[model samples]
Target chain A: MTTNPNTSTLDYAAVKPNDTRAYSVRNILSHVFALVVAGFFLYAAYGKIGPVNARQFAVQIGNYKILDAAYSNIPAIILPFIEVYAALALLFPKTRKAGAILMAGMLLFFICAVFYSAIHLGLSIDCGCTGKGGSKAGWGVIARNTGLLIATGLSVWLYQCGPCAPKTSVDS
Target chain B: MKHIFGVIVILIVSVITGVAAKAMWYDTWSPTKAAPPQKMAWVKQQTSDAIAKTGADRNQPGTSGDASEKVTDNDAEVSDSSGATDASLTADAAVSNDEPEFSGGFPVAKLDMVVDHLINGTAHFVDAREEYEFDDGHLKGAHLLPSSAIYENIENLMAVGVLPGPGKPIIVYCGGGSCEASHNVAKVMAEFDYQNIYIYVNGWEEVMAEPDRFAGQTE
Candidate 1:
């Protein structure tokens, strides 16, 4: 199993099956990150879809006081589906980046809304982030969203570095 | 560019699926139609008509049992601030001597009484908060009667057979801390001729404070 002295170090590492393919740390980490994010978003969407209460969800949206009551219904109707689509898009290799982008954008919006409603307005209302029964939108929720944003960024970055990414490297 | 295309595709799919899902379970949110922009006078007329219907249809009482237990002194001479103070309506109301006397148009109930009503189904608990807050946790048998679109919400309420016209002790509560949602909802209830409406001022906050006792009471 020893590398021949004749082979150069760069070529030797490249030839190691463990190093490049089956055991690539970058690949596993990327998928793991994506899996976590996808699982989370899917779970969130499930909560919304399970109850399937658009009007109630719209009221939840209105609680943020960000959107006018009239405007809240459309988002409430569509947001859960968006989460599901984004999570699916992320799991697939072709649309992973796009999903990540969508997820990151949503997380950013949620963070701001939670901050404004829970922290700024001091409303003791539920966040409704993960559908019904979500906790109040407060500092703790802000921290959680921020962490999710970081994870989202890392998922895409790591995915790009993984073997699934289109490669332009030349072998020695 | 591909990423953008992929995102657009995802968005389109989401919109389509969302619409389908909304259609599939339209009943769950059909009540929210009240929030849309509607002719005010028309809505008011519809609401008044509904209220009149409710007012006219108040003959039957709740099924005999604990329902009759919450008898209110409809003719009680309560002060403005303590609307039901001297009424001593229910055993739960008289259970505690430390209960806060009302400070508003309606009588205020203590957490114990609210919890008791919840357990016994002695009163129809109407949650005055938004649907989302009600979803988080609310007293069992609580009606989500937010005051925003009272006309439509009440119609929805009536559709569900929850006619609150001068019958059971209607306990209305909201997110406590200086929140006026409960009071607003109570006023609307009064407009519908709902006598014996009690306000649980420290509603959600109090219920949330004692996680253990009220834990099982939430929907």
Candidate 2:
């Protein structure tokens, strides 16, 4: 390829074609939020796989007293993999919205479960956020889940096919 | 519409994978599998594995050490499969801390004594593990009084005639291995002035060590 020698080459004020700044702020923030939410769910899912974890999670759910013993096992078996799928979805462009929605729904469910256990039942039990050891169910866990819910919402809407995608950045 | 489809796909795949994984570990986590209590099941498997490993190592000259012989010699008599060798309630527990300080001034149950008690049904056995664990496996005729649910289930225990009675021995056990559920249950029982409460500090793990004899005793 030959340059046009007659033309002025310098365009210092304009963003360089290869500049990192060319990555739109919306895209960058979305990527960051997507990664954070994905990492959180992935770690959360890690501790819930396998039979030992299933047993612990079953007991944790039983602590909630909302579900009978027979019913709790269903969630114990399926919930971890749900988190895993949602996390992987968040990492992919095609399914990011689905992941965000699923995670947001899960956070809402968790917030309610914790609130019911802590406030309604007045039970001081292990939150079982992670399989074995995690914080107790109370205001702190609710606050943390709320933060993650907001993060998931932001992750979905910030860029690249999201409603909040910048007018200029196509993520090409 | 696209997001809904994607969400459904993720959920469907997750549910399928989870069910398949459960089937893969059926022996460990199958809901329909009617198995003995966890204590019995774990102890039996561990015992058999240890026996098989020991059989292979027995030919090794030094490895066939006198540990078993020492145990037999240290105790007045080793418990047979029926646990009928000793009739005493405290058959010289192998634990170091049996004093008042260890179990908060509570009497501790010996393994042999526990077995004998279980067989004879002379004592009320309180399972201190979670309800789910108790459902999986527990001592035969043991009361399902999980320490965490004690307040809720104590009345039920009374209704079921599993309540601790005067002069009758109460043996409380948990999942062992630093498990304090038994102690916690005992604390509550103490408040009600329950007599002859014996805390099994080693609990399920100690029973698991001799699972061949214990397995038949569990549900």
In order of appearance, the predictions have TM-scores of 0.57, 0.51
- Report how far residue B90 has shifted in candidate 2, in Å: 19
Clash pairs, model 2 backbone? B37-B137, B38-B137
The clash numbers for all candidates, in the given order, read 0, 2
lDDT of 1 at A91: 84
Question: All models, DockQ values?
Answer: 0.26, 0.19
Candidate 2 chain A: worst 10 consecutive residues by lDDT?
A: A163-172
TM-score of only chain B in every candidate structure:
0.58, 0.53
Candidate 1's clash total is 0
lDDT of 1 by residue, A1-172 (tens): 3444454233444456654663367767777888888998998787666333455466667767788767987898889899999998888868889999899999999998888887888876767777654365688888988888888888888767666322334436
Candidate 2 ranges beyond 4 A from true positions: A1-23, A160-172, B26-219
- Model 1 stretches astray by more than 4 angstroms: A1-18, A21-23, A50-52, A164-172, B27-171, B176-219
Chain A only TM-scores, each candidate in turn: 0.82, 0.80
Question: Model 2, range A64-169, lDDT digits (tens) per residue?
Answer: 6678745878998899999999989988867888988899999999999999977787665557787654366789999999999988888777764333312333
